[model samples]
Target: GGDGAEEEQWSQPGNDLSLPAVNQTKGKCCFSLCPGIKIPKVMDFLPNILTINDSSLPQARTRCLENGIGYREKCFYFVEDEAEWNRSETFCRSLGAHLATIDTWQELRFLLRYGGSLHYWIGLRREGSAPWTWFNGSLFNNSFQIRGRGQCAFVNGDGISSDWCSLMKYSVCSHPQTRPTGSRRDPEVWNLT
Candidate 1:
C-alpha cells in the first residue's frame, strides 16, 4: 500500500460549509473539518480581507444636507432616477458634485446595501482605448474583471462591472456638504466669499 494516512475530502450528509471561523481577536482559530484534521487560520491564507484597519480619513463635508451621508472623507448621495451615464454625470454636476467614486470595499458595500437591486452608474469610464478612470482623476484598479460590456462601470451587489455608457441607470453622487452660513434677507451684509 502507498501512503496509508492521506486525508480525503468529503462532505457530511447535511452539513453546510462556511468560511473559517473568525473571532474578535485577529488571531488563529482552530478550524477543523474532521475529527483529527485541521486547516490553517483564515488570516494566514488571506490577510487582506481578514486584517484591514479602519479608515483614518476624516468625514466628508457635503453641500446639500437633505440626502447626503458621510463616509470616510466623502459624502454620498444615491440618485433614484434612472438615466444614461452622461446624463447622470450632468445631474451630479448640477448639484455641485460628481458621480461617487468608490475607493474601498466598505464604501462599495454601503452603496450596495442601500441601492436596492438597481445598477448604479458610478464615476468610472474608459476614454476611447484608454483604461477606465474616475471623473475625479482617480484610477480604477481592482480584482474584478473589466471585460464583457466594456465601456462604462456600474455598481451592483455582485461588484462593479463595465456596461454600455448609453444604458440608463441610477447613480451615486459625492461632493462637499458644507453650506454657506449667512442670513438670506441680508444680502449686502452676507459675505459671498
Candidate 2:
C-alpha cells in the first residue's frame, strides 16, 4: 500500500518533484519509499554524445578574433614545438586573446585530443587559500572536471597530466571579442557605454 501510495503521489500531474525540489527536503520522501536508490535530476546527467570536427573550428577562431576574450566554444590547438608559455600569452594578447579556460570535461577532452605533445597551459591558477581562479579572476565552482597537482595548470596532449605554467610550453588562446584599440572596449561594451 505504501508503494502504491508513493507511486500515486509521484504520478500526480501537477507535482513538480524534480531532484532539486526533492533535495530541498533532505530526501524525506525518497528515504521513506525507495531507500538506497538515488534519483538524479535530468540536469545532473552528463551528456553522452558530442560532435567534434574542423568545420566548427573556423567559427570558433573567428569569434575569438572578433572578441578580445576567450568565448569557450572555440577550442584551439597549439604547437608545443613552436612557442613557449610567455610567447604564447604574448601572441594571444597581440591578437586580443588569452590562455584557454577549461570549464568542462568535454572541453578538456577536446583540447587534449587536438593539442599535440608539449603540454599547454590553461587559464586556471590558485590564488592564496581560496579555490582556483580563471585568468579573468572568476571563481571556479565546478568540481566534476579533473585537475592535476601543479599550481600553474596545463592540459596535456594525452589529456592526463598537468604541467607548469612558467615552464616553456605551447598553448591555445581564446578571445571573447576583438578589443578596440582606442577604447579598449568591445562593440557590445561600446554600445552600452
Candidate 3:
C-alpha cells in the first residue's frame, strides 16, 4: 500500500516519526532505506561521547575557569565598556586572568548563554598574520558559524564573531594559573578603567 516516495520521505536521514501510525507505516520501508541515514541512537549519543572526551582534556576545564573569570563554576561576567585588544589583554592579565580562548563548542555555548546583549571581547585578534590569532599568538582555527565585521572576537549564545577591539564592549577574562590544568589558588582582581 506504500509507494517508494513515501518510503524515501519517511526513511530520510534525520527524520524522526514519533507517531505510532507513521512509525508502523514506515517500519516496513526501513529495510530499503539508504545506509547513509543517520541513526537516532548515534545522533543522541555522539554529543555525549564528544562531551566526555572534551571534559577529559586538560585544556577544557582550564578554559572553562578562564571564561568563568576565576570563579570555579560561575560564568564569567562582562564589563559594560570595552577597549582595544591589547588593553583588554592587559586588563585581564592585571587581574591574573587573560582573555578567553575558546577551544570547544560547549565552552562557546556557555559563553553565549552567559553573555547577554553585550558584545564581549575575546582573545582573538588579527595583528601580523592575515588570518586572525588568539592572545597567545596562536592561529584562530575554530569554525565560528556566523558572519560579522571587524577583527575582534566575541562569543554569544550562538558562536564567535569578528568585531572592532577598540569598540567599547563588555569582556570575559581567565585566570593565568588555570592554563591547561584548571588549577587556581588566588586570583588577582583588576580595577577596570
Candidate 4:
C-alpha cells in the first residue's frame, strides 16, 4: 500500500520529518512508521557522535593551509572557537575567507552534518525591518527557517537559526575559487563520507 509519491516524500527532508537523503546509508533510514511516537531525524541526534579527534587536529590545520575544507567547489573552514560575530568575521577575513554563506540546502546540510553540536555563526543578518542578507551582499531567500529569535544567524546540528549578533560562538569561513588571485583550493580536504 505504498504510493510513489509517499516514497518520494520520504526521500526528501521536511516532507515527513525525515533525515536528509545525503546523510542516509543505503539500508539505513532515520524514520519508522509508529502509531504514536515522535521520531527525530538523524541530524537531530548525530551531534554527540560527531566529535573531533585530537589526531585530526594536525591534518585539519594542514588542510586549511593547503586550501579550504568542506565538500563543494568553494573551500570552507570550521573555526572551532568562541568569538563574537564581528570578531568571527575578522577571523575569517584574516584567513582570506569570509563567514559561511549558504546558497543551497546541500551546502547547509553539509555544514550541519560536520559542524558538530555547537552553534556557529554564519554570514547572515537582518537590520531593523529589513530582510536578511549574506556577507556577499545577496538577499537571503529563506531557503531554510531560522530556529530561534534574533537578527543574526547560526547553524547547529538541527539547522540554521537566528540569534543575537553579539553572541560568541564557533564559526565557519568560506574562500571562494573565483577570487581575484585565481587560486582554486581542493574541496576534497574534508571527507564527507
Candidate 5:
C-alpha cells in the first residue's frame, strides 16, 4: 500500500491471479486446447489437416525422434518401409519411442485417416485370448471395435485390424514425454511430463 507497484503487479502478464483456470490432468485436453471447435466423435479427418511440419524436441535424457511429427502432446515417427512386428518394435526402441498407441476414439480416427490405404503397425498386442495391451504395458480400453483376429493390431483405411506379428507392415512410433532415459538398471530421474 506504500507505492503504486502493488497495483501494477495485479495486471502483470502471466501472474498467478491473472491466469485462467484449467483442470489439471496428465494428458492433453482437446476441449481446453481448442475452444469452440467441434471435433467429430467418429473416425476420419481431412487429409493434410495435421500438416507435414515436424516439431523439434529437446533430447535431455533418452534418445528421441529428431524429425518426429507432432500431434497433440505426442511425437510420432512413421516408418515408411515395411518390417516385422518385432523388428518394428526394435526400430522404435532405438528412437526411444514405442509403437503408436490408440487410447481414444479420436486417436483411432486420426490414425485411420492418417495411414489411409497403407497399413501401419500399432502398439496393440493381444496374447491368445488375453486382453489387448499397449506397448507401455497398459491395457487397451476397447475404445472402438477392433477388426480381424491375430496377435497384433495395425491401422489402415478402414479401421484397426489384427494380423500376424510376422507380417510386414509400416510402423508408427510414439514418443511419450515421460519415457525413461534408459533401462531400469541405469534409470535417470527426470520428469518430462
Candidate 6:
C-alpha cells in the first residue's frame, strides 16, 4: 500500500523534519493547520491570502499568464513533468505555490477544458476513509463529484477522479496573488528572522 511507501519519501535518513529531537528539527511550522500563522522570511515568496472574486478574473488571468492560466479567483499552472502526487505537491510548494485547488464549478470547467484529455494531478487527496482535502488541509466542499478509486485526484475529460497517490502524472500548481507581508496571528510562533 501507499501507506509507508509515500511517507518514506518525506522521512528519508538525515531529512531535517524527521530528526525526532525537537531542537534538531529545522522545518517551519505546519501552517496548514496553524490558522493565522505568519509566513516567515524564507516563506515570503509563498502566495499570501489575497481576496479574489468574480470581479478579479481578468487581473488574475494577467498575473498568471506567461506560465499558466487564471480563472475565477486562483491561478492555475500546468506542470508538464510527471510526478507522484506528493512529489508533485512538493514541487509546487518549492515554487511558492500549491497544487491546483478548485474552488468552484467554473474553475473546474476551465481546468477540464484547458487540460482536455491529459491527466493532471491536482492537490486533492485523502487518507483512509477521511474526506477529501486540499494540500492545505481544507475540506473539499464536495461541489463536484469525483470518480475513480485512489487516494489522489486528477482531472481530465472524464472529470475529477481519485487514483493511487504513487501514480506518475502531469500536475497542476496554483497560487493566490500577492498580499502584504506581516506577522502570524500567534505570538508563540514568531516571524522568522
Candidate closest to the true structure, highest TM-score: 6
* Order of candidate numbers by lDDT, starting with the best: 6, 4, 5, 1, 3, 2
| Model 4: residues with Cα > 4 Å off, grouped in runs | 1-67, 178-193
TM-score of each: 0.55, 0.47, 0.50, 0.57, 0.59, 0.59
Off by over 4 Å in 6: 1-62, 179-193
Query: Residue-wise lDDT of candidate 5 within 1-193, one digit each (tens)?
Result: 2321111111222222221122223113433433332223101221212221212222243334576766666777889989989899999988888899866677677777777899999988989999999887899888877799889998889988999999999999887554222111101111112
Q: Candidate 1, residues 5-111: lDDT per residue as tens digits?
A: 23332222332222333322322223434332233433243332222221221223323457877776678888989999999999999877888887777888887
Count of backbone collisions in candidate 4? 0
Estimate the lDDT of model 3.
0.54
Q: Identify the superior model by lDDT, candidate 5 or candidate 6.
A: 6
The sequence of per-residue lDDT tens digits that candidate 2 reaches over residues 1-193 is 2322221112123323212223322334543444532444312321210111222121223343332323355535353444655567677676556778766677666777766565777666664445777777898676534366655567776664444555676667764443222212122212211
Which prediction has more favorable TM-score, 1 or 3?
A: 1
lDDT of candidate 6 over 1-193, digit per residue (tens): 2222111111323222221111113324444433333234224422321222223222222256468666665778899999999999999887677899988788888889999899999999999889999998999999999897789999998799988999899999998764222212222222322
Question: How does candidate 5 score on lDDT?
Answer: 0.63
Better of 2 and 6 by lDDT: 6
lDDT of 1: 0.63
Worst 10 residues of 3 by lDDT: 184-193
**lDDT tens digits by residue: candidate 3, 51-160:** 42334334433333332443444335465456766687788777555788776666677777778656778888875337877888888775675347677787665567
Q: After superposition, which runs of candidate 3 have C-alpha atoms over 4 Å from their true positions? A: 1-77, 176-193
Q: Write the per-residue lDDT of candidate 4 for residues 16-44, one digit (tens) a residue.
A: 22222222232232244432222343235
- Candidate with top lDDT is 6
Instruction: Output the better candidate (2/5) by lDDT.
Output: 5
